[model samples]
Target: MHFLLSMFPSSIHPHLHPHPHPTTFCCRNAVLEDLLEGGTPKPLKTGTTIAGVVFKSGVVLGADTRATSSEVVANKTCTKIHHITPNIYCCGAGTAADTQKTTDLLSSNLSIFSLNSGRKPRVLMAVNILQDMLYRYRGQIGAHLILGGVDCTGHHLYTVGPHGSMSKVPYLAMGSGDLAALGILEDRFKPDMELEEAQLLVRDSIHAGIMSDLGSGNNIDMCVITAQGVEYIRPYQESEYSDQRRRKYKHHPGTTGVLEEEVVPLKLEVVEETVQRMDTL
Candidate 1:
């Protein structure tokens, strides 16, 4: 894999220099960090929120839909939990272009491997391939992915970072919002979490991240993967979420979810204002 990264010239931007080395993938699609002559870019806001949790039944992956370019929220509804195959899905974080390309690379390789091997590759196999691919690009590509699925090996979850680091974890969160999301998962995640509970847990975790992190929100999308296959839980609208807040405070006041305070647990009454505002809708 190192040999592949070595193949590219040291130059991060292949297009601007017209170097002897063949064009890098980054050349075709420019990265946000590129210093274009005199124009200074707002510190590349690749902030995103992606969470993956492993349970006895299956894996649950979730991400927020806000994509930022500098100060601009580029897309309000970008899909981050990408379908790699029927049994495989990846949660993309970091730079949007790199994440998209990385998933494409993984999906394409898995397809080709399945065609040649006469069988679908397992989750670990896919992770191994992706680790190698990421290793090859290593420092050149800034992308992060939380790969999860139910292969023949049962449920598996892996996080791959641009540094080419791979770690098998039961639950993880990545992106600028990860610090906030990780706090929730650390406090409540369990080995025996049910599918429905896991879905709600992930949703709540994403909300905390979005609430506290500068580049994490707008909407939420979740991908639940079990032996039955993948099921997408659509985005929760602001109105619907506010309504949920009221119900949660009425039904279960102490539990985690949208009602939880951003940094600490607050009185459920704090949400009453938002609930009142929602009445107009």
Candidate 2:
């Protein structure tokens, strides 16, 4: 009878099975695993423009506040510039907290080692550090950074993306409005642009971005970082530039017509024929 009972499986067999309990430890800092898989959604704020120009003097970095969430304006005068090293500056446009944390980590790490090293960090070293930090918390949270500075040689600029992708250029911009701003900058930029010209280029680039990106706004804050020191130009209203562009490109299609002298005006019959062919196609 005991042998027959042993051969039969019991309903409570799972309880009789041996299992080990999990050991938990005190978590000293915020763990990414919890934030990602613990069912807690992260809060975020959005809006910013990152534009920079490399001139004979050095690099000029520009960022605007005018952040917007769901087409609603959020904050004005939100800063995006951080001093990674004495000569290097990092500016970004994206999640405000993540970007700020990137700067904070860099600053804290540098300060802790400054006494022993006795040397200011370089832009490349700072960038590698930032890239690794960003790589950790990379999902759905990242910053578009523009790192600019003067090394021992001269002015330099680099655009860095979320996944540690970076590229060097004489000038660089990153944001939703980059395409529009690039159109304006491409036409205006010279190889070795001077300080005054660089200022105008930066302003014009921001102005272009303002027209295209609803999230970017407010008066333009232009900064000149050269061999001398950092100079923050007074903010100027964008409306002034909008009015000027309106005057330049303003055209009345139905009324107050202005025709290009270079093109001979086509008659109504010619226009009708072209429309007929387009319709057929």
Candidate 3:
């Protein structure tokens, strides 16, 4: 308190101050610092690159295949794109299991709804369900998703966060590599891009993320949603960053000479025995 008062002009008395002032440092940071000092900090488990775009005729969604847990790469070719319905697809980021189960739940709900209504489910319906579920969880679910689809209304693209916040955008990126991916999307995206062009753009965006972010790599996957149907492409592009082995490490069986061979045999005693069968009533 004295130190804070010293910063003010000596001409004005301390009691003469008009009102109380907020602290200069954030309370959250102070609490975090105390927690860190008390124990070893664990690395957060997160990684992935996912993006979506709305084109003239349909929607294109892209994702990288890498999954990371803290500093370790958990899966090299894991699928991030998930199917919600025939027309709606999602690209998930954050905790792998969380995203997988969340999408599975969405798919199950949408499927049931479609069956009861005798018609296809809308994209907005899926989005609403997802947001409500996420909101109820209060960000504990740890799933960030990019949803894209085509329904009777039209082509749609949305980004849904773990906290239930959502945004409708023509193009959007998510995950640790989102910044890098968004750079590519923002630079070349067009309103009326053709199917092929939109696909290529999405592919490039994911590729950019893979190249720039350690959390995103392995291969690229894409999903295209059109009025006719949905097309899911697993491994739309392979990662060029992976290095091929110069020479095969596997050697022929005879490559190494056998120094010596020893065979041990166990002596066995054989006995013949007969067992009586029991009569059933």
lDDT of 3 by residue, 176-271 (tens): 888999999999998999999999999998988888888889999999899999889988998776677899899989999999999999999999
Cα RMSD (Å) between model 1 and the true structure?
Answer: 18.0
Q: Rank the candidates by lDDT, best first.
A: 3, 1, 2
Off by over 4 Å in 1: 1-43, 236-281
Between prediction 1 and prediction 2, the one with superior lDDT is: 1
Q: Which candidate is the best by TM-score?
A: 3
Model 1 local distance difference test score? 0.80
Off by over 4 Å in 3: 1-45, 244-281
Cα deviation of 250, candidate 3, in Å? 11
lDDT of the candidates, in the order given: 0.80, 0.67, 0.84
List CA RMSD, all candidates: 18.0, 24.2, 13.5
Better TM-score candidate (1, 2)? 1
Question: Which pairs of residues collide in model 3?
Answer: none
At residue 183, what lDDT does model 1 achieve?
97
Candidate 1 at 226: error in angstroms? 0.7
TM-score of each: 0.71, 0.66, 0.74
Better of 1 and 3 by lDDT: 3
**Backbone clashes (count) for model 3:** 0
